[model samples]
Target: MGRRSSNKQQGGGGSEVAPVRLHIDPERPAPRKLEPAITALRRGHVIVYPTDTGYAFGCAISSPRGIAMLRRLKNMGERDPKPLTMLVGSLADIGRYGHMGNAAFRIVRRLLPGPYTMVVRATSEVPRGMKNKRQEVGVRVPDHPVCALLGELLGEPLLTASVTHFEDEQFELQEPEEILRRHARELSVVVDVGPLWPDPSTVLRFLDDEMEVLREGKGPVPD
Candidate 1:
């Protein structure tokens, strides 16, 4: 069996679709729940859950099967994969995932723990499934307890970010318990820390030569 398992209800032009739900405050240790969440990803499960900024949905970086599952969830048809932005606990922890220079470091230090996603070069350790194919990756530092708790427990940088299964809008599912009830079979576990903001993280991509604002949202990273 592939790493991902899904049980979705399709409502489209004769296409199979998976249901996306929210899990809010379940009866489990935040990290214990995270184990299954990561397990599902390792086994190829695409999930949508809460984040510091809003809700982050994606597969586990360590799982190529999960990456393919996420791609299918995103409906991506490209041959090579493009790196997606991910949330990290802090700047120090991201050393294995992407490259953060002094300038990028200064900028990220100023805007993270608030709401912002920084696009930068990827390190060799970046997953081939998640890297831009050219060694570039987008990274973020979230200032929320659940975000830290999950990272602390997992002991690895999770590729958590705000992405939608459907196009034309950002993927924002804010309820944890509801999500779990709907797709429990699809996921091994769902972490229900608590309610979080209903907003998405702000996006900023740092060019080799300069800084460029990609998408503006809740958290305002300064110049």
Candidate 2:
């Protein structure tokens, strides 16, 4: 068990926004205890939680409103928005949402649950707006207990984006207090697993017949 704190905006003309921060013990890694965060996400609220790369903000992939909240938090306007990544629970879930060829599947199955993001063609089940103009989406299965458990609790993939305040910065915010101080107003929940070492996941793209390395970060790319 851990402590919880929240912040809410008052006397506002807009929708009521209150972001709660909850702590999770890394050693325990309890999935059943994350019900509140799951409930918030089910209601189309975005959350900031720890991942293998660092802290990231995510929401239910099916919620357009949640996507909008995520976009607003990241300052991604509809006119030209950065493509959001999906955090899936397993490789099977990835297949359900993305069309993966045998070659792509082989590589993905071997390297997932690590620090990597794979870009693949999206399936019809994927929301239209969530994909790139090429009909592809970036997916990740982070190697962290909290996120893995959170994904299981939600029973679906989460639309994810790395947490970064400055564009030049390559890593996400690592401290829970700092994450709350900057983004708690816009977020719905922050699942803190203490402080994290800052880094970014390696991004790999599997297009038609080629495997291209998009960005080299914490994970090593296979030749």
Tell me the number of clashing residue pairs for each predicted model. Answer: 17, 0
Q: Write the per-residue lDDT of candidate 1 for residues 54-121, one digit (tens) a residue.
A: 65665556766556655554555435454566667777756656666677767777676777777777
How do the predictions measure up, each by TM-score? 0.71, 0.88
Instruction: State the lDDT at 212 in candidate 1.
Output: 77
Candidate 2 positional error at 48, Å:
0.6
Maximum-lDDT candidate: 2
Model 2, range 97-201, lDDT digits (tens) per residue? 877788878888889889998888888988876887778888888888888888888888899887864356555447888877776566767787888876878
Residue pairs with clashing backbones, model 2: none
Worst lDDT 10-window in candidate 1: 11-20
Measured on C-alpha atoms, candidate 2 has an lDDT of: 0.77
